[model samples]
Target: MWLRVGSYPDRELAMEMASKLRNAGVRVEVKEYVEWDLTEKYLLKGKLGELEEYEEAQEWKRYADIIRELIRNGMEVEAFEREFLKRAMPEEFEIVEKARSDEITDDELVDAVDAMMKLSLLLSSVYGFLKANGIEVGEYIQGNLPEDPEIIIELDDWAEGCEKVYYLDFVPSYEISVDVLSAIRGGAEIHGMEGAVVDAASRVLMNLIAGIDETNDIEELKNYAVGVIEDSKEFDADVYVDAEEVFEIMLRSLEKAGVIRISGKKVKFRR
Candidate 1:
């Protein structure tokens, strides 16, 4: 379970909270959110944890909100509390949907619970929906989400009786490793057969698209992706971009909007 604490002007500011939370023994993930209303850029991050119970999770979330409110707004804690509550409740709802894992992925992503409970359904509904409508979702992804859990409401094919439910890690395939991608983009090259950076990049993209699930990474996937490329018709004839090349191209594309930068394999994003 993750508990979002407060917004910061930069990672440095967020790190201040992270430092405190670390001292208090909490896990943290610093995420950069793209802000639409602000002229100056900022970031929002929450301390994260994987507690066994929801109550423990909520307890820490409350603690984080109090402490971060002190840090971000000083005496205006009341206002901070109000905003946090507004954000926290819905965020918790979002988190609950995401709690489900991918051993349960499918086209609809929602499991049908009942007609009135359309929101709680996942997996079977998506499969049934696409198949019936003659619509197609990707093999691995099947579909993408606006955020995690990626809920799709109203399936009258929308079967009112059955609702779609996503209840796990609900990860999407094709999420690139910002770290490696950045290194490659920062002009760090890797040697892979006679392939160019594009080839490596394509492999990386495939892994992301597949959204390989594991507590620890299965390195063999890299080899498998590479083998597929090697067996491809353009095996050695093209100046195939390696993973790094793809990273460079992708990051550069992102940079056109002032959202990112690559330095020595590090990715710093601004929005």
Candidate 2:
């Protein structure tokens, strides 16, 4: 009979422990165990309601309410001019009011709202990516959005009276680096050499592993992995990777490596 020696929330750490035990000539089988009870589940449900997307939606609604109140008080752009710039522009205040009153008919307003929504989602996703990569926002740099996928960040205090600007273009490329190849190989090793697929799914596997700790929701993780691959500049342009295929391969590979175990809708890391 195997005895439970330890439990870990971190999948990578659990895998490391399993590897060490196996190397010491001790039999080890990493298994997933759920310890969440009713109270924990209730807490998690409450936390889910406070997610960033929900917060952002609430913020927009508040802005709309404020704009409507300003219109009622006979103050339009003047109110925004005195206050700090919110996510929406001053001119968008009128648009918001018009939208709320069902008076919005201009295609331009529709396009503006569409663009704003897209930009908001893009910024949120990029922030998460930067956080995962251990990059701190407002540390030494400030981001300026001139357009979609083309962000220019100004780095402060680089040298004496010298300002450095870094341009981050979230566009896919055909070039693949050696580091990416190594990551792909590492992912493949989880399920043996023959389990590897040299397509787009293989590329996504690398990012999926990196973002494993970001979320326990497999569907969300799969979407994030796909989005990362789509925005990456290191993807091979010639290869086609399916999102569904990537999710399937990712789950199988991680499970085979004893890094994770899927039970119903929950994915628990081996401990």
Candidate 3:
């Protein structure tokens, strides 16, 4: 008999349940069971059965679709039981659908994508700034690059409850290119500003983008970035970050500090 081995609130969960049922000597099939208990996070009322013949299986599948529509529209177990109690199809069909509820349309996917793009662009700009400041922003990435540099990072969008968040996992032993490093290093070297934009951008990216989530004031983070670099005397991920992100942040900071006016990505330090 073709039997629904499991029912779930979501396709993934249903698949998992069906897999386990298959392993347990049962003919498992995944079915989307809706009309869940809002508080319990599981499907509430649904009918499932075993089909004995090919014709019967097709008929069951067709009937299940009608039931699916009912559940999706919010059916209650008590109401369904009261109605179906008079006519019993089978004992297993009396069983309630249960599984972790999930949304088919997760908005977190979009939010995560946007967040990552913003972060990547910010990182690239900051890295650029670091290079302008005489700091070797790409040194770490160049050193730690994986077997493949182009595929350096994997972007993941995840749901944190109802909200979607994005994160990046750098490829094994690889670093993201902070492309703005060269420009920022130049700015620092020409102006002799003591690590200059690189210093400022590094600290900001470390705190904001990197996992080092230290709460730092603008002045402190700027000093931290420069100090870490000057002391280490090499490209360091522990304190250093994508120089490009730092650059964008520094432009904003400098504008805020009245040290320069950043217009259309061109930050002109006031002479």
Candidate 4:
């Protein structure tokens, strides 16, 4: 997948940023977009596939595309069923064939199909919930079951009837520059500030880093940073004197440190 890392009105600047990141061992790509005869913008994107979950998503998408194509090619239901059985495990094929031949009546088949459709809808809802909660479907498939009994019951009911289930696990993924992480962890001076100020800035920076994955909008990140600072002030008012000002300063420092790039209304992480 290609993730937008930076945007610039000037093509040269965008390419320059891409080159810099590429030289630093990060995969980068630059593309140009033109407005309706008004303006042109350059976008810098980074390729992401380092995670097993990402790879799984890609493979799942490919498989879905293949199935879609097969359907579009006018495959009959019997042909499709044969194809499905060809791909099914031996035990699964036996169970499904037996159900079709002897175990399932006409009304029971209708009920089973209805339940399957309901289960599909339920899985879609679950997928959206997991994504919103920062979960990966591939990770969930690898033995990360939900803790809630109701959720487990729903899943088990569906899986018992259908003989298959898809799931995802919650795991927040964020990439931060090594230098920035080291500075934050080692308590290094940030733009000549130390102690509480550094701690506050580090906390805000980490939040911003995590937030950027969700949104690259500069204002959104700034607002999120201010929220973090405000939450911290509830504990130690002296640590953060001005949330907005502190966020601005930290953003500039991050830009100066080559950990991030700001262009117009967008902020992009280098990593």
Q: Stretches of candidate 2 above 4 Å error? A: 1-199, 228-241
Better of 1 and 4 by lDDT: 4
Worst 10-residue lDDT window, candidate 1: 107-116
Per-residue CA lDDT of model 2 for 35-73, tens digit only, reads 432211111111222332433334434333443343343
* lDDT at 238, model 4: 41
lDDT of every model, 2 decimals: 0.35, 0.42, 0.32, 0.45
User: Which stretches of candidate 4 lie above 4 Å from their native place?
Assistant: 1-182, 185-194, 228-242
Which residue pairs does candidate 2 place in steric collision? none
Tell me the lDDT of model 3 at 239. Answer: 44
TM-score of each: 0.16, 0.24, 0.17, 0.26
Candidate 2 steric clashes: 0
Q: lDDT by residue for model 3 over 210-259, one digit each (tens)?
A: 32134223333343333334443333444433444344454465456455
Least well predicted 10-residue stretch by lDDT in candidate 4:
147-156
Output the TM-score of candidate 4. Answer: 0.26
Off by over 4 Å in 1: 1-177, 181-199, 202-228, 231-271
Model 2: ten consecutive residues of lowest lDDT: 39-48
On a 0 to 100 scale, what is the lDDT of residue 81 in model 1? Answer: 34
Candidate 1 C-alpha error for residue 261, in Å:
16
